[model samples]
Structures are given as C-alpha cells and as structure tokens.
Target: MANMSMTKTPIAEQDPKVRARNFKEVTLGYTAEQAVEEAKRCLNCKHRPCMSGCPVSVRIPEFIAQVAEGNFEEAYKIIKDTNALPAVCGRVCPQENQCEGKCVRGIKGEPVGIGRLERFCADYMADKPMNIEKPEPNGHKVAVVGAGPSSLTAAGDLAKLGYDVTVYEAFHTAGGVLMYGIPEFRLPKSIVQHEIDNLTAMGVKIMTNMVIGKVLSIDELIEMGNEAIFIGSGAGLPRFMGIEGEGLVGVYSANEYLTRINLMKAYLEDYDTPIMKSENVAVVGGGNVAMDAARSAMRLGAKKVYVVYRRSMDELPARKEEVHHAQEEGIEFLVLNNPVRIIGDENGRVCAMECVKMELGEPDASGRRRPVEIKGSEFTLEIDTAIMSIGTSPNPLIRSTTPGLSANDHGCLIVDENESTTKEGVYAGGDAVTGAATVILAMGAGKRAAAAIDKYIKSK
Candidate 1:
C-alpha cells in the first residue's frame, strides 16, 4: 500500500549566483532518511512497467521495496545486476523519458523518484567495500574502441564473461564523453573514474592515446591477435548552423568548449593550458548539450549567458529538469529565434550575432512542429562569444581508413541490429552508428554489440 500522506520529495539544488560563478555539484543528493521515504512512494506494483521502460531493465520494484525497508545494500545489488554504471545513470539519465516516466503512481500524482533512489542506492554501494569476483581467463582477447559509456559497458560485460578485454581510447584519459562532454557539476569526474576503475580492477586493459585508425587500423587489430573487435567510438564531430563568421576568434563549437574545460581542466587555471575566456556568451540549440555548454560558460566567468533555440519552449529536446535548472541558474532562454550569422569585430573576434524570429508550423519528419523563419523579423544581438550546439556526427578517421566498413550517407556506420558492421568481427555502435543520440541508447547499442561479439568469438 502506498503512503497516501507522503508525496515524492523534490531534490534541492545550489543557489543561482553562487553556482554560476563556480563549477561545483548543483543538485544535493537525498539523505538516507529522505531516500527511504521516497522509496516508500512506490506501490511495489506486480507488473513492473518501470522495469520495461529502462533500457537495462533494472529491478525497479524490488529495489524500491528493499530501500523502503532500509536495505540499501540489497537495492544496490539488484540494480548492479543489470547496470554497470548505476551511479552515473542515476544522475544524468533521462528518467522522465525512461523508468520514472512509466511509474503507475505518476498516473495519479508524482512519479516515484526512481532516479534519486537509484542514486542513493548506488552511492551507498560506492561507499561500502566491494569484493567483486573476477572471471578466469577465457584464453581469447577482445578489443574495444572508445571508453565512453558504450565502450565501458561492453568492456565490463565482456570482461565479466571471462574474455580478456583491452579498451583503446583516443583521449589522454578514459570515460570519453562522461569525463569530457558532461560537466563536473552534473556528474563528478570521481564517480566516472570509480566506474572505470571497477572495469580495470576486473582485468580490462585500457590504452589511452590510441586512435584505432591512426594508431592501428581495424585489420591490424585482427592481425595483432584480437579475436573480435567492438567499435564503440562515439560521434565526435561538431555541427554548426552554417552561418557566416563561425570561424571568428570568440566562436566555439560546444565540443571544443567542453573538451577544453572538462577534459583539459581549464576551470583549474594552473592545471590546464590557456583557453579562450569570454564575458557575454550565447549558446545555440535546445538539447542538454547546449544547456551544459551555456551553464559551463557562465561558470567559466561569463557575466551573462543565453540559450538560443529555433523552436518554442515546449519543443526543447533537453530533459525538462535540466532545462528548468538552467533557467533557475539565470541562463536566459531566447526561444523562437534562429541565428543567421555571427558578427565579428575589427580584430576578427565575435562581437554580436544576427538572428531572425521563427514561428511554429506543421509537424515535420521528426514529429516536432517545424520552425519557419518570419520575413523582416531579423535582428542582431551583442555578445562576446557564441557557441554552436546544434548537433554532432561520426568522425571520419576510422571510416575512411578501415576497409569494408560502410557508412551511411551521413557517414554514420551502418550496423545490423546486433551491431555487426559489413566488416566481419568488427562491431560498431553508439553515436558512431546512430549519429548524436542519448547516452543510454548508445549504451544499449553497445550492450547488444557486445553480446553479438561474444557469440561470434565463441562460434569460431
């Protein structure tokens, strides 16, 4: 029976001005007492629809029941059986679009705060001493490219099944997008490092600064004694609005901006090399990445920040919670507007931007109402920096060098449902296959590919 008197507890966050000036965790997590109360909101339903909503099918009701009884360790055990990176998932995942969104309680009142409870359980588990049992050597080696969520999931799973796994990453460190693409405030790098450490402790070999196509092609991997290959290399190329003056000094692609700050540690001035610093900045797009970039820019000391999206507020693709957080942190939302061009000053630095008003029209191919430009509604806004968060694509380095690997017209690799490429034993997934997509979805693709590669190697 549900506690009719108790509703879900809303998680609190940091204050606007203080958070804007520094890079620190914004959302304070639920305490043990609050977590138990939140867990009690679960009806402990029989059908378990929430489980179906999760890509990894976490045991939602079981975990909730355990938490409701103050059995945090038991709850963690159930979630970890299905997910390798529960803590990370609990924080950044779009539970509204996934697990929590399907809660039966949500039909009447607020959904059981599944994400918060999940975080609680996972965090509790992280605090405890872990004695994970490692699988004995299966006498075969598998190579995984890219150490993002996808590669990490595949590598962890493969290692558990006793296959020797070596993960090759392009960056100086592992946890590709998690460490660099996501801000430290949303998901602390320590949590990401902890997850990677779990894999490494399980005997998964990680080689950093090893770009597969550049360091060694896919064919060479097979020749070098790899039984099978999983290319979880995510989409790394940034897209722009194709507006003029994008090459101006103060203009940055969200990819570069995030990479410079998150990966290079530009926030810790003495640790990282120099990167461009701005005062007034505008970020173009509505996705979570755009919000992340815009918020990060403010923390990097920008006086004012703007989120410029072509569509209306209802059409924003970022998680509702994140969008709300951005607004709460004082990020200006300039909806129903589209940038036409970036204006530059005499020194070739970004000075301002020219934009036009847009109106919602009939639904387009993506099912969202298309935005139409309004004639004579053009205007210009002054700003020191502009960042394009429009979208991203697969990098062409591997596709161009790896023979027999066919990519779609957009250069995203075409793979089977099992994530097998045209090239034998060379499996690919994540954004590298689907272009820009949700992290969980990319991880789902990686999980499927890992299973397929496991089967392929065993068959041989």
Candidate 2:
C-alpha cells in the first residue's frame, strides 16, 4: 500500500541554539529504515515529470525504486551515471525548485524526500569504497581550465572517453567554489575531496596554482599538444550597491567573507587568518548567498545577524529550505527594506546601516514585484559589520586576455547552445557563461561541452 502521508520523513538535525555556536554539520542523514520508508512515498509516476526538472536529468524513479528495495549500492550507481557530484548535489542542489518541485506526490502533500534519499545513497557508498579501472588513454590531450564543478565534470567525462585530460586550476587547491564559497556545515570539504579523488583515480591529471590567461595562454595550451580547451573559470567578481561607506574596514563582499571563513579556515582557532569579530552584523540581500552570509556570521560569534532585503518574504529568491534554516538559527529578517548607506565609526569600520522602507510595485524585468522606496521613511540600525551579497559576474581576466573570445554586455562568455565560444578550439560554460548559477546547471554545461568537444576531435 502507498504511504499517503502529507509530510515526508523528517531528517534529524542539530539543535539550532547549539549548531549556531559550532561549525559542525547540522543535518544527520537518514537511517536504512528511514530511507526505505521515504522511498516508498514515491508514487512512481509513469510520466516522470521529476526527471524533466533536473538539469542533468537524473533517473529519479529508477533510483528511488532501487532504494525502496534496499539496493542502496545500485541506487548510488544509478545516480552516478548522470551526476558526478551526487553527495554535493544531494545537499546543496535546490531540489525544491527542481526535481522535487515537479514530483507527483507534491501535488497534495510534501514531495518524497528525494534529496534526503539521494544523500543516503551517496553517504552509503562513501562508507564502503569502490574499485575503479583507469581508462586507456585516447592520445588526444584536452586542457580544462578551472578545477570547479563544470571543469571537473568535463574532465571526468573526457577522461572516460579515453582522452588525456589535464585540469589547470588557478587556486593552490582544486574544487573552486566548492572549496572556498560554501561552508563546511552545509557541504563538507571532505566530501568534495572525495569526489576529486575519484577523478584522480580515473587518471585525470590536475595542475593547481596555474592561472590560464597569465601563466599559460590559450595558444600555449594548444601548442603543448592540447587538441581542445574548456573554460569553467567561475564568476568571482562581486557586485556591491554604489552607496557611501562601502569601503569601511568592517565591510566585506560575501565572496571575501566566505573565502576567509571557509577557504582560509578563519573559523578554526588554529588558523591565524584575520577576520572582524563583530557583535552585530548586517547582510544586505535576499538570495541564498545572503542567507549563507547571515548564517555564517552567526556561527562566527555575532550576537545578532540581520538580513536586510528590499522585497517581502513572498518574493524572497532564496531556497525555502535555506530561509527556514536561517530563521531557525535566530537570524533577524528586515524585509521590505533596502540599505541606502553604511555608517562608519571613527576607525573607518562599519558602525550602523541607514536603510529606506520599500513597498512592492508592479512586476519588473525579472517578473517579480519591484521594490519602490518610500520617501521620508529612512531608518538606521546599529551594526558593527556589513556584508554585501547581491550577486557576481564572470571575472574579466580570461575575456580581456584572449584575443578572439566574445562575451556579452555583462562580461559573461558568449557561447552557442553547444557551449562553444567564438574562439576556435575553445569552449566555455558554467558561471563564466551564465554568471552565478547552481552547481547542477554548471555540471550539465560541462557534460554537454565534453560531448561537443569529443565530436569536434573525432571529425578532425
């Protein structure tokens, strides 16, 4: 009999009060029994609308059915066939808006715990190691710039096709944003390393601290016997509101803040990285990045963290799960307000934030209700630190350096439907082409580009 419960099985988590004070992972994954119970909730719709919503098109029903029968290992393999980073995606992917959003069971009740079940299978496989055979090299050298999700996916796929793949990363370590952008409490660094390790086991060569446009040019890579090159150098340029007091000492872009806390290990007592110890912090934005900044501030010992958003709760662009987690962690929401200026102290550090009240108006370009400032409704909140988490554009290093490369008005790389750039023998995708986007979307771009590169090489 089908379980008709309106609510899905609840995954255990750390107490909000306790977790807010520590950097440990919050959600404890489901047990074997719980995984089976949750898997049973899937009605196994014949149409499989859930698969359509996924960027990489994971086999949803097949994997869930395997889990329901307790074939955990088989489930992991099914997910792995399409997704390169199931563990990371299982945790960070916005399934509520993607796969689970189109679930048939979600029509009346909560959707089957798809993310949780996926997490279970991934975690299960990690606990028990698997042996992988190295693919015989195809003698064609492929150079992949940026050791991020997109490049990693491209490299993995190319390697599987027997191509001699070389991944060049600008940072000292690989994993790009996965290494520096996301916090460990959300997606652990260990999991990321494990995924990278798998690529190495498959004979993928990684070169770290190698900046492509500076240290090596597209011509240099091609001259070194590389038949093709893939660019996935993600968007690292941070955007800020052109307001006064933004250059204050305590003010930081969410990129820098997250990089320090997550990448530099400032959260660890042993690390001597300098970070502002603020009593109160204000994160200015409404997206998932803003929520991450606010929640990270709380974990870093800020007594109070406020999210200052221009739009109302209904229009919040962040994933609902993230918004809920932020609320549980005691983050104060200053909705329907936008920051006008940052008030700084004598030391040139942030002290307060001046904001104006906002009212929802007619739908704008993005289609959500636009926020209109109310005159004479300016207010001020006392804060010691400020973080701007608006958004980001692609870094201009590669575009400015490459002669024939083309980019749009936003500075993001201009690519065809097949992820090919204007430059011959060069392709680009992920944040370099789409600005900031989800991990799964980036992976899909990489996979598609790999196929196109393969076809191009074969024709030659």
Ten residues in a row with the worst lDDT in model 1? Answer: 1-10
Deviation from native of the Cα of residue 140 in model 2, angstroms? 0.4
Q: Please, what are the lDDT tens digits per residue for candidate 2 over residues 1-460?
A: 5667788988999999999988888888999999998999998999999999899989999999999999999999999999999999999899999999999889998998888998999999997878888998888999999999999999999999999999999988899889899888888999999999999999999999899889998888999999999999999899999999999989999999999999899999999999998899999998888988898999999999999999999988888888999999999999999999999888888899999999999999999999999999999999999999999999899888899999999999999999999999899989999999989899999999999999999999
- Most TM-score-accurate candidate: 2
lDDT measured at residue 377 in model 1 versus the true structure, 0 to 100: 99
List model 1 lDDT by residue over 39-74, tens digit each.
Answer: 888888889999889988888999999998999999
Counting clashing residue pairs in each candidate, in order, gives 0, 0
Candidate 2 lDDT (Cα, whole model)?
A: 0.93
